[model samples]
Target: MIHIEHVSKKYKKADNYSLSDLSLFIDEKEIFGLLGPNGAGKTTLISILCSLIKPTSGSFSIKGLTYKEHKNQLKQLIGIVPQEYALYPSLTAFENLKYFGSMYGLKGKSLDEKIHNSLDHLGLVKFAHKKIDTFSGGMKRRVNLIASILHNPKVLFLDEPTVGVDVQSKNVIIEFLQELNKNGTTIIYTSHHLNEAETFCTRVAIIDHGKLIVKGKPKELINNNPGAHNLEDVFISLTGKALRDHA
Candidate 1:
């Protein structure tokens, strides 16, 4: 469903590429995980795929449509839940969602129903009228996710959708995502939660220094790496124990 070819990116005056000729594919309905430590180019690659940033070289296509030739179509084809909350603090949850849905050309009673259903599913219906600034981190995260799927996108790109939530909220989010996947949404997400990815993802790619170091089923990767017992073990073995700090 998604194809990336020799994609590369370099920020202005950067010492190294954020993504270097990286290539991969994600099948329809697959939950693909991009796992790496900080500064490993995961977000850069997602940003490129989401068309939030342009690649310095190479290209990619989603569902046989390139952003260059099919910008509007591609915009309708995917949803994005960024790592940071993309909500209006002053707006009520319902109000914020209505604004977001309208961006995708959604309106009327159907849009209202969609928002309410999503809020109920994510356990935030009670707070629908509350200002975003008053919601807890978990509530805002849930609202953020609801905003992305109002139009029912074919592909969902989530960057750390469960970053700061409590265990209950995380479980709810994961369950909600699993439901979406079951209904045919292809999911590609980047997360530092190795354990979650191990069980949640159909396959995963481990990247470092702007390159794909390994890609496979979590069990396959774990079994293939000698002495590795889990995805975290495989990750540490492949990416190493050193810090990836960058300015």
Candidate 2:
């Protein structure tokens, strides 16, 4: 469903590429995980795919729709949930959803029903009438997810969807995503949680310094890498034990 060919990107004033000649193909309805250290270009690759940042060199297309050829069509085909909370703190959950649904030209009873249904599905029904400022971080994240998928996108890109949340909240988010993938939403997500990716992803790619070091099913990678018993073992073996800090 997604094809990335010889995709490379280098930031202005940067001495090296953020992503280097990376080519990836993700299947339809697959939950693909991009795992990496701090400066491994996971975010850069995702941003390029979402068209948030133009690639310095290289190209990609989703479901045969390239940004250069069908920007509007691709926009409608994808949904993005960034790491940050994309919500109005002062607004009620219902109001926030209404504004987001209206952006996709949906309104009235149809939009209202979609909003409430999704909210209920994510365990935010009672909170719908409450102000967002009163919500916990987990609630905000769930609401942020609702905003992105109201249009029912074909491909969803999520960056750290479960970061900074309690175990209970993280479980809810992962479960919701699983349900979405089961319903045929192709999911591409970046995460630092190796254990989460091992079970959640159908396939995963480990990138470092803008290059794909390994890509395969979690079990396959663990078996192939010497002394690796799990995804974390394979990850640390490849990316190393050093800290990846950047300015």
Candidate 3:
């Protein structure tokens, strides 16, 4: 459902490309994972796809609609759950959802029902009236997810959706995403959690230094690499053990 062709991005005053000639294809309803170390261009690629930033050259299209020509239509087709909490600390959960739902032009009883049902599904029904500032990290993450999917997007892009949550919350989020994929939403996810991506993704691509190194099913990648017993082993084998510390 997504096609990226020779896409590259180099920020102003930067010496090298953040993403260089990256091309990828993701099928409809597939759970695709983009894995890499810090500064590996995963976020750059995602940001370009989300139209939050423009590419320095090359292009991409979502469901055959390019951002330059189909910006509004593409917006309706995709949802983004950013790594950061994109919530208002002052707004109640219900209020926050109501506002986001309206962004997609949903309103009235329909929006209300959607918000309540999502809240219930994500185990946040009891805190619907609670302010976001008062919620824990897990609660905030759940609410952040709810905000993105309220419009029932056909393609979802999530950047580290379970970064700091507890195990229970992570499980719930993964299960919820699996259900969404089952119902026909194409998902593009990026995470450092190799174990989660190994099982969750239908296919994964490992990129580094703004280039594609390998792309395959987790099991296939693991089996193909001699001495690699798991996705983590395969990952470390390809990306290496050096720390990716950045300012």
After superposing candidate 2 on the true structure, give the runs of residues whose Cα lies further than 4 Å from its correct spot: none
lDDT of 2 by residue, 5-41 (tens): 9899999899999999999999999999999999899
Clashing pairs in 1: none
Candidate 3 root-mean-square deviation in Å: 0.6
Give the runs in model 1 whose Cα sits over 4 Å from its true position: none
The clash count for each model shown is 0, 0, 0
Query: How far does residue 224 in candidate 2 sit from its true spot (Å)?
Result: 0.7
> Over the full model, what C-alpha lDDT does candidate 3 score relative to the true structure?
0.95
Candidate 3's displacement at residue 95, Å, is 0.5
Error of 2 at 31 (Å): 0.3
Query: Which candidate order results from sorting by TM-score in descending order?
Result: 1, 3, 2
For each candidate, what is the lDDT?
0.96, 0.94, 0.95
RMSD, one per candidate, in order: 0.6, 0.8, 0.6
* Candidate 1's TM-score: 0.99
Q: Sort all candidates by lDDT, best to worst.
A: 1, 3, 2
Angstrom error at residue 17, model 3? 0.5
